[model samples]
Target chain A: MNARVTPQDSALIRSARFRKEREADWRRLEDLVEKAEKNGLQNMDFAGTRDLASLYRQATTSLAIAREISLDKALLEYLEALTARAYLSVYAPQERLGGLVGRFITKSAPQAMRRSWFYILLGFLCMGLGALAGYLLYLENASWFYVFMPPEMAGGRGPDSTTAFLRSVIYDDDHSSSGLGAFATYLFSHNTRIAIFVFGLGVFACAPAFLLTFYNGLILGAFYALHVDRGLGWDLGGWLSIHGVTELSAICIACGGGMQLGMAVLFPGRNTRKEALRLAGKDAVKLAIVAAIMLVAAAILEGFFRQTVQDMWTRYLIGWTVGFGWLAWFMLGGRARQ
Target chain B: MRSPAADVRKAQRLARKDRRAERGRAASTILPPEGVPLNLPVASIGVRLAAQIADVLITTVAAVCLVILFSALELTRPQTIMAIAMLLFFVIRVPYYILSELAWNGQTLGKRFLKIKVVAHNGGSLSTHALVLRNLMKEAEIFLPGTLLLTLDQESPVASWIALAWVAMAFAIPLMNPYRQRLGDILAGTHVIHLPQPILLKDLAGEAKPMTAAKPGAKGFAFLAHQLDHYGAFELQTLETLLRAQDKFMSPDVHARNRRTVATIVEKIRQKIGFADPIPPARAVEFLRSFYNAQRAHLEQRQLFGDKRADKHHAADETPQ
Candidate 1:
């Protein structure tokens, strides 16, 4: 009835129907292929859409070519190529500045914006307060300076003259031994941990807050008097300045960490202490990580290089340069990246 | 007509093309072209962004609330830690969906309520593996340079560069064209589709119940109906066309237009029926069949007795001339 449908005839009819239906798919393939050709691919990664895009290109091209002629192996190869090509296009590197800016925002937003003011105020306050305490301690009992100064430096001064001991140790480079260097490194690390803990614990506003700040001040006072008694006060100051700047700054940073923690507990903002502490801990932890990095760098300079460089003038130059350099770095260079 | 042999050769060539075409058609449903002009329903980007923001907000709020609650309760350190741990569970573990996919899903709870869903590379369901992979890959989305590689000179390569790495990773998946699923989805072997909620005639008639069955026969109708109901109107329209093309209710129609018309009519019936609880298509049809059988019995009885039955006989006999 339908034109003497034979097996072959039926097959032919079926084929015709299939071809008619597949026209849209073939056209879509062509469009994707054309788009791929226009936008060539370069770099490829496994995580994104690199392979799918390539295969799409190859498939589209093969379909396009195959549609023109009959099925051919060569045409399939073309399809493969087209697919790879299309996949590669999407995988190619994205725009550069756009990504950097995004990273800058993500990293910098919390640290600088949220905690900057508190750190600045605390750092300056500690320095000024420590210097005043040191002056008072020196004026009260000059020999008491030995309490703050390292035992080796204070003990070296004999009955001949306290000034001689101070000069020989603080101002004089001969006494700066490698053992002392190692000791300083160990002390710095221990002190750093304490500082970090203090800063971390500052949220309570009671014991940790007082202990961390007062300990720093008392140490500076004792060390200042020991040097002043030796009559090499300014010289010792210059020598300490080189690596001390970074080292002390790191301590302040640790305090900032503590302050961050302590504030969370004390103020609690709209949050309860537990919630506030946990929430604050995220940013505070990151700050601590940054502080650790700064501390380590300071340790390297203090332990290995600063101890070895001994000329008072040389030490002063190096100390001031390193100290000022670190100040500039923390205050400005870091902020600019964000 | 042309030579029978020529017709056969032409038919064979055409058949090969048709087979290829069938595969192509299969692939189309798998991955439609991105941003085609067709009124393909997609959840708005704004809605998706909003949903994501809400998820983050909820997560934050929960964390804060738990911490506060613990402090108020004077909970022990371990308990506080546990509360914090639970609050940050998603950030620490399942980062992807909460950040991007959740947003892509929709803007508001209302949109979610509306049953609109989002899919990657045209609307396809994500497989389980893909669900995990996509979420895991979000680490790169946050940390890697998403748009950085654009300005780098092709001549020089940067190591430890995240953007390039991400590109390579994405490219590895769906390389065969048209399927366009990411690697995660490919491994997971799943696709996303709007959950259907189609209403059956019986449902419209207020006599439908949620029936469960294992096979695709009568039970699958509810499944299909549910799938239709979940998709937006546009997706439902496409699905209707496909179903009509592969109609199983009766004999296949030779005319494409007629087949399409029937599908359109069925969809119209579904809209009009408005079932609060949808019934499966097979069961609905089955119910209709039983009703017809009863009607026939009544008519036959009437004919044998005193009533006229000529119209019923004619209607039954008029199948194939």
Candidate 2:
């Protein structure tokens, strides 16, 4: 036991003693964190949870103290890792199921929509311009309809189609073998995939978002032009109005959401592109999810109401009501609380 | 391929690659609100790829299972069945990634298997928004390119070239970044890091005994303040590592070599610290272990007064022989 102890040995000895005293708490915290990580914090009792929090705080303070003193690497690293793991466990985002969903409905989604009114308007205007161009081009020359609309997608509907054929295609209510349920689900899922793609690609400077929305509007205008050429335009309008109002708005909102991403990258303002994108993503995702929900609603109307109700006035009434309802919801919903 | 020369060259290349890879394990220093700097070892690109491959396999299996389930449903109409299968193909992968990460605290099944996790770059809680954004970009980064590659041969030359370029860029994004972040991680402000594993060893404060012989009452060497000041925490840790190693389990030949190494280190420390005491051959390790304890205690205690002697290099010119 012959060793030269220095004047500072008391302080070093105190740190060693400190490690010995606090190690048990650290070990307990590690065990609790491991168990909680494996089987969730909810699995732990109230006493255990309180103990975990207290022990975590002690561990963090120990880490801060140990670093300043330049303690042994092992103890220092142990505390660092322990505190990090404990930090993640303690500060985990706690959202109850109903509260999360409720907040999204009443606050997040609508607020997101209102905030990105610029992008939404941009998306709609692009589509509107494309629709106008398509209408004028097809009206000038019948072949312009064929140029804008692909043969496979046109499905035998063209300028040459008779009035009776166009009317039957719209007002028809026969989907027996392939039921409306399957059809609805199919449309919902298909639109969802396109919506997601539009949302994803909008990160690439918004060019694709513009092109896709414009192309979609062109197809819609060409189809409308074909019906108008046969003088069954108003009847076809009723058929489309049943779901088109909600469906088009959804696609536009998806485009807006996508464009939001691109705009963030393009014009980051004061922050870096990544920072702006992350901030924009919070709202963009909300808009996207709400747009998807609208698609689901549109798919329901398309498959059931559009198929069952053949009355033109009733279809227009339902479609306009839905369109106005969405506008009102976007303009007003979730605003009062904030 | 089986020739000895070729195999040797291949082994050399592999060893070199391993060296390069070891250097690539960059650490992200996160200063939490507590103000302690915690170094998180970011996952290497190779491990990340392996995790991705596992995730891709799971997603592919899921897609196939969905196809089978849809087939079993007997939706007789080909069109409806086709639509459902097509939707399931793209839909399953996104939600699989999202739900797993959200459910498991930024760790998917593959990440858990590989012992890596997604962490926020800002050193805070992993946001649900970041998770969704990152996973959503997977569709653009991997799945779309994967879907395109399936029909690359049938596509026109330009389309095929464009598809190949997209595939290359998507893959190269992670490789080009120091943190190995794909476009998704870059945008989402997240990092994938290896889990921290700090194994606190038994402190060698006073545990110095002869390894080969049970020499009781061996001479205890005491280092003076100036002598202990010749080395610092780094040298102390190196000495501790040497002391903690076990030579008993090795063969007689290797055990002799290990003893030689320890003797060499003991002599070096004695020379460096100007210790004149004659340590017996049996107490050579005991001498080294005592010096390690004294040096560690000296370094830590000196640090109390803000004299952080990191290594012997810092002590060379500062203290005269």
> On a 0 to 1 DockQ scale, where is model 1?
0.02
Estimate every model's Cα lDDT from 0 to 1: 0.46, 0.77
Q: Which candidate achieves the best lDDT against the true structure?
A: 2
TM-score of each: 0.36, 0.85
Model 1 agreement with the true structure over A1-338: per-residue lDDT tens digits: 01233353232222233333343443454455444433322222342234345445444544543433321222233333333323323332233435544543355433442456575467547755876786687678766555555454445553235565556665444433343234333433445645544553465553565566656766676666656655667887866776677667667766766576667767888976655765555454445545555676666666566557776688778766776765554455435453
True contacts kept of 1: 0.00
After superposing the true interface residues, what Cα RMSD does each candidate give? 20.8, 3.2
DockQ of each: 0.02, 0.34
Q: Show where candidate 1 strays beyond 4 Å.
A: A1-115, A143-161, A171-190, A334-338, B1-321
Per-residue lDDT of B125-190 in model 1, one digit per residue for the tens? 322223333443333332223324544565456533534665665554444433444433332332
Best by DockQ: 2
Put down candidate 2 lDDT per residue, B1-321, tens digits, no spaces: 399999999999999898666656434676666666667778888898899899988877887787777668864355566656555755677778987887778888899899899988877787777887788777778877777687577637876876798789888888876677888888788889888865666555623323213554444677799888677677776666676675347888988999888788778877877889766777787777667666776787888888877777885656696
TM-score of 2: 0.85
Say which docking band candidate 1 falls in: incorrect
Residues A1-338, candidate 2: write the lDDT tens digits.
Answer: 12344454343454565665566777788988887788878778998899888888888888888886644666777787888788777766555546766888888888888889999999899889888888877888888887878675666888877778778878787866235436536474445556766777798899988887888788788778878888888998899898889888888899999999999989999998878987888888788788878987887787668778889999999999999998888778887754
